[model samples]
Target: MSNLPENSFFESLKAEDLSGVAYKNHLLKKKVLNYFSNFGNSTIQDLSKALNISTPKMGQIILELTENGVVQDYGKVDSSVGRRPNQYGLNASSAFFVGIEVKKEYINLGLTDFKNQLLKFLPHIPYNLDNTEEALDELCKIINQQIDKFNVPKSKIIGIGINLSGRINYKTGYSYSYFNFSENPLSKVFRTKTGFPTFLENDSRAMAFGEFKGGGIVKEEKNVLFINVGYGIGMGIMINGELVYGKSGFSGEIGHIPLFENEIICHCGKKGCLETEASGRALISKFYKKLQEGSQSTLSHRIKSENDLKLNDIINAALNDDVLAIELIDEIGKKLGRGISALLHLYNPELVIIGGSLAKTGDYLFLPIKMAINKYSLSLVSNDSKIVLSELGEKAGALGACQLVRKRLLQSE
Candidate 1:
């Protein structure tokens, strides 16, 4: 179906190379956009070398693409000894994909092109995790409205990527948590409800993909591990530049690891799980219990009821140096760090990223995390992994969902 010229060498893409529906027939155009999508900004000479064509021929194709609004002038790059060459980039308007990250409190929506350019963003849309139909109804409404506003045909949107917290079987696309959707695969339900091809992934794994490619760090490294600390702690492991989902897609359940021997129970019915002692939910519960036991604080008056308390409230309290809040967070950090050290011993990744809501606590969390790693991690691999905070903030999961569709469309396998 390619619009490639009769003499063109580019043939049909292999069947295994496609995950979602193909959008266009311009093989050369697809290749050009794929090049920019993978390598970011580049000059005509660079495209020529990748495509194995003369610069003049590349220029001619680029001129056609620019005139059609598919390519744009990125800017001029100064040459070492001559006139500067113009750099080119993909026009953001040419195509787009949908990414959605579902949290218990709200949902984040994003739109991006093949170049991984985020054309629009929407955050903090209220959603109730208990009612799947109501949530899906509202989600479709929002996505349809955005597509109409952008004037892109639904057919051109390669897919919609869904990232959520839960035990997800990627092959079956069912979750053992949040909406659990036993009647059909969650992605199938989403696809049927929205009329877009759908891909589903764990939230932490999705964020790892986004940071790996869209965060602009994929080029220099081949191994990474992302530890997401939120309502629960989850791990996303990447080895040799590819994400490892493990057998049955439930590999990174770090929160369920029995790191403590205490009597506390986890929501998953496991006793003494890491999440029972270290998760954000655990932090808030511990803080509230202390308050109930007559511990005084400046926050006591502000929080008239337990219903008004949230993880953000505790983090804000800590930022203001509330002694009680700091103590609780430090405890959570130590428990979290113990789990991280276990990962360090098992994976030996080059970089370990701390992401999700708690990552915003900055050094308050890292100090304890590093201390625990130093005390328990094997010296051979602990020093090899560099632990740092995620720069993508709360949007990491949403953007990572977008990366799923982009990678699928381009077949980055």
Candidate 2:
């Protein structure tokens, strides 16, 4: 594939390599882009007033941007007094982004335009997460294949964001969990392999970004927690309108917190972890063990072995009113509530989003979670938080990945 547009303002924005008047101009152009990104169409007068630039200077930048095909005239703004001014907005086709969500069992890839609209979504590509070079190569290969399917020009595709589970230092582009054998940062390796600027993000945090920016659930709320109850429980924390990435970029590992007294071994090789009792893995384990002990369910005949069972199977069973499935999901929800109660005390988030496959169980899961939160946490603290399911659903991770790429390129002082 061809590389990103050479020596173009888009490339300069990514490189951040300019100085003196050129740098000031670049910053000004970026400010206009950012303004359009955040607030949509704007008149030259509106942009100049909002960005505190003179109308003549703003008009010059807008004209240059229009010539460069980065910004387009979006027609006249609605008005009743005197003449209506022409509005300008981002040219959605001017650039594209690719987002990949890597899971233990499958991968989700999505293509988004400059407008943050998902153009294509390809989910459940059979792939296993592992710590190996071949696995990483396979991932890149799949990414190339999926992007090829979209048929967007290589130069038009600005960057690729890949979301992985486990400890990821996004600033330095290093993943401690997978592909750590290489001396180079994983992001650099991906950039080299895929021939596009590549960024790495933690899956949960990326999902949180997706919700915060595009899920339409958050309007003015600044503090929120996204509970990712997938194969394992993970959390994406937002504080003061920013995603929290602690030292070493491993902040949101809420699953590893030892909140239980159980002897069950977690995937992290620890005992009494929240994941040991409350995650999808834990639910599946409990369900399988119950079946082995002669417990009956509607899915018993359908599932001949534990390996044949899927999270969707349990969700569908609960939706069909299977007693065993409902009971198990409720139990997991209660444990999850106990875990979230601690977060409420600590973060006091304005919203708590329940996400992942188990979240599909809806009220069968949320009702017990609410009950347990009311029972364990202080009323004052828990009352401040509103828990809801993710609006972006299974697509949040991929969509968030695309948004992160945009954020990195467009971030300004």
Who wins the TM-score comparison? Answer: 2
lDDT of 2 by residue, 298-411 (tens): 989977788888777888889999999999999999999999999999999999999877888999899999999999999999989998888888789999999999878887
Estimate the overall C-alpha local distance difference test score of candidate 2: 0.90
Per-residue alpha-carbon lDDT of candidate 1 for residues 1-413, written as tens digits (9 for 90 to 100): 22222222122222335334332335556677678876777899989999787888788878877876668998899768888889998777555688988876778888887577777778777765554667667766766675566556554466778888878776687876756545888877777767666788899999888888775444477798988998888888889988888888987899999989988889889899999999988988888888999897668987766766788788888888888988888889888988999998888888998988888888888788888888888888898888888888777788889888767655533
Prediction RMSDs, each to the true structure: 5.6, 2.0
What does the lDDT read for residue 282 in candidate 2? 89
lDDT of each: 0.78, 0.90
Tell me which residue pairs clash in candidate 1.
none
Candidate 2: where are CA atoms >4 Å away? 298-310
